[model samples]
Target chain A: MSRHATAEQLSSYVDGELVGPRLRLVETHLVECQDCRRRLDGLQRVVAGLHRLEPLAPPPVLGQDLARRVRLEPKPRDLLERLEEHLRSTPLQSTVGFTFALVFALAVILYLFSGWVERQVLLHQPVLVAPSEVGAGAAVRRVGPRSFHAEDGRWLEVGVDPRGAAVVAVDDGVVRQLLVFEPELEPLLDEGVPVVLAMEDPAGGPGRVLEILPTPPEP
Target chain B: MEAAESTAAALAQSDLDLVERHRYGDPAAFEEVYRRYGEMVYSLCHRLSGDPDLAADLTQEAFLRIFRHVGKFRGGSSLKTWVYRVALNHCRSRLARRRLFWRSLAEPDEPGPEAVDPGRSPEDRAIAHDEGRRLTRALAAVPVAYREAVVLFDLQGLSYEEIARVLGVRLGTVRSRLARGRERLRQILEEGEPLAPESSP
Candidate 1:
């Protein structure tokens, strides 16, 4: 108000944002001030010219065209790409992308680790073997009634019926082997003979008798 | 008769209601919005870009964006303002890239002549042809930020608050930009040539 209304003040006044005593004071100064009034007039003329410029009517096809294009816009499919787009448009773009990248990377790493975990379990755990399948040279220890612990750390449970045939159970499956246990061996099996059986296939197959060992006393 | 009136009233829906209906999978609601805002958005793009073809492209781009992001629109601003903001942002990014491309080629950023419409009467064309050209040149001369504020305020008739919301700037910043923009436009009109490009404060 002192050195003449600045261009900003005059513009604000034209916009009708200036109010109260400030508006009145500017009005009083404008009445007495020719230079400020001229500035105001110039600004008004520029604004008026802008307003007078004809509004361009879009082409007749514009609506349909835009609608068609909008309909055609491809939706995001990849979750990461969709998230990237969402983050890029938001204020938190920078941090969100990095966080999502880390989470995604961690998920991949955990998925890979799960496969390794299965292999590691297989490597460290004991392999089961049937007492009948064990060969004569194999090391065997009788640990229970009709059960033997082999040197390879496998636990095998062997059962023999009165007909001189034997069955072996290992890892939740039964391996039926026609056993020609000698007539003497059949009674020993009925009395709980501990024998190491080695199978060609551990999952389920016919196994050979390797050795019959004395049953260890139960502790 | 009463049922017909009610149906007609329902058809005459507000922008927000139409957007809501579109969100719920109403294709007609989306088409209605497209019809309502298409011309205004295209015109805004045309004036801001000073290129009809580019304006059409930007117009399509804006609507595509709106269609995709409609669900994300929280009702903080009026639907009109939101649409305008989307269209203007598209224009701003494109013009910026065009400016960079032109600058790389050492070309001045003056807009080309307005596209002539054969449908217009000779008299109307004769009256408005020069005035429209001069206004376009003056507008092109103003820097992008200031030009945007001046266009939205004077040409499009958005209030300062709406301009602020659209531009994501403070109220004071809007006033400053508008004032400086008007001054620059006046100087360009008086000089009959665009001012050299300068950074806006």
Candidate 2:
């Protein structure tokens, strides 16, 4: 208050930042100090000039671009709400329901066709009839490496004259037929064992397996 | 009349209500907030950075950041203070990264395009334009920290406490910065050295 006001005090005074005693002190000093008054005037002019400077207008596309970007973003809250709204409309609801029905019909058609495809695969490949299917009891004997004859009057051979193929022959009194199987049955084809060739599907490819029946030994 | 009244009502809504509406997915509320504060933010960036293009970019980035983090805006401070804080922080980070490069680039002194007001007398417009150019040049010469304080306190009319919050500095620091900034601006004007043209990074 006694000496000329400092530049900080004058600046704070011009900004009205100083309060109470400090404010009164600067106001008192400004009355007698011409140099400080001129300095305060300069600072005030600078602030006024800055305020008068106009702001640059933003680009016209800014708002539109921002809106588009915001819309494209996935809004988890709005998504459920929009879906519910869509479902409330009867036409859209019916259209969606019809689409689901079409998908179910296609699935049924594919399922029925799958069974036909399986039958075709069975006919082309060798069909292995179980030993019991040929007759209730039939004694079988191996005639060759890939051939077999059964007491039920059926003959069996490896359809393709391959070394590892399975052949189950049955010669029942009524009829005789040859049954060929895939190479996977070779391990189970034992002489004098009541083994049944099972036409079960192989996991890797189109093939079948042979099962050895558990027959009780004669006392 | 009804529409105007409704607009006034909307404007009167508290910042918290507007922000909450935006959080609840009200696009109009967010747009209203943008309309209310966008120009002020743009002007702050323009003064802080002498380059108009960088200012525009900074302004857009600030608003995008605000939109992204609206949920985190607790009502600890007024929305205006928080927004100014966001804008100033962005400007500071940008300035820090480009400080050396920005100083090295020298530009020719040229006034940017000024929009002439048809309503104002030619003499008044001319004087205003000249004053604006001089002020802008002088501000550019001030050190960034001081310039920020002066621009916010004097031009943007923020209180000392609000500036402290924005700059994340002590009240004393704000006072010193504003004082020094004013003095530096005055000296630059008195010396009559034409302010170097502002260059964008």
| Cα interface RMSD of each candidate | 6.8, 5.3
Tens-place lDDT digits, model 1, residues B1-201: 999988645543465687677666677876777777887788788778777777778888888888877756666777778989999888778778877311321232333334466667777566455556676767777887898898888888888889999999999999999999998877767676432122210
Encode model 2's per-residue lDDT on A124-160: one tens digit a residue. Answer: 3442334553355454433222233343333233343
Model 1 chain A worst lDDT window (10 residues): A160-169
What fraction of the true interface does each of the listed models get right, in terms of native contacts kept?
A: 0.45, 0.35
Best by lDDT: 1
Proportion of the native interface contacts kept in model 1: 0.45
- Give all candidates' CA lDDT scores: 0.67, 0.66
Q: Candidate 2, clashing residue pairs?
A: A152-A171, A152-A172, A153-A170, A153-A171, A153-A172, A154-A170, A154-A171, A156-A169
Candidate 1, superposed: residue stretches over 4 Å from native = A74-219, B1-13, B100-125, B193-201
TM for candidate 2 is 0.56
- Report the CAPRI category for model 1: incorrect
The reply for model 2, stretches above 4 Å from the true place, is: A1-3, A17-24, A27-34, A72-219, B1-13, B100-119, B193-201
Superposition error at B10 for model 2 (Å): 9.9
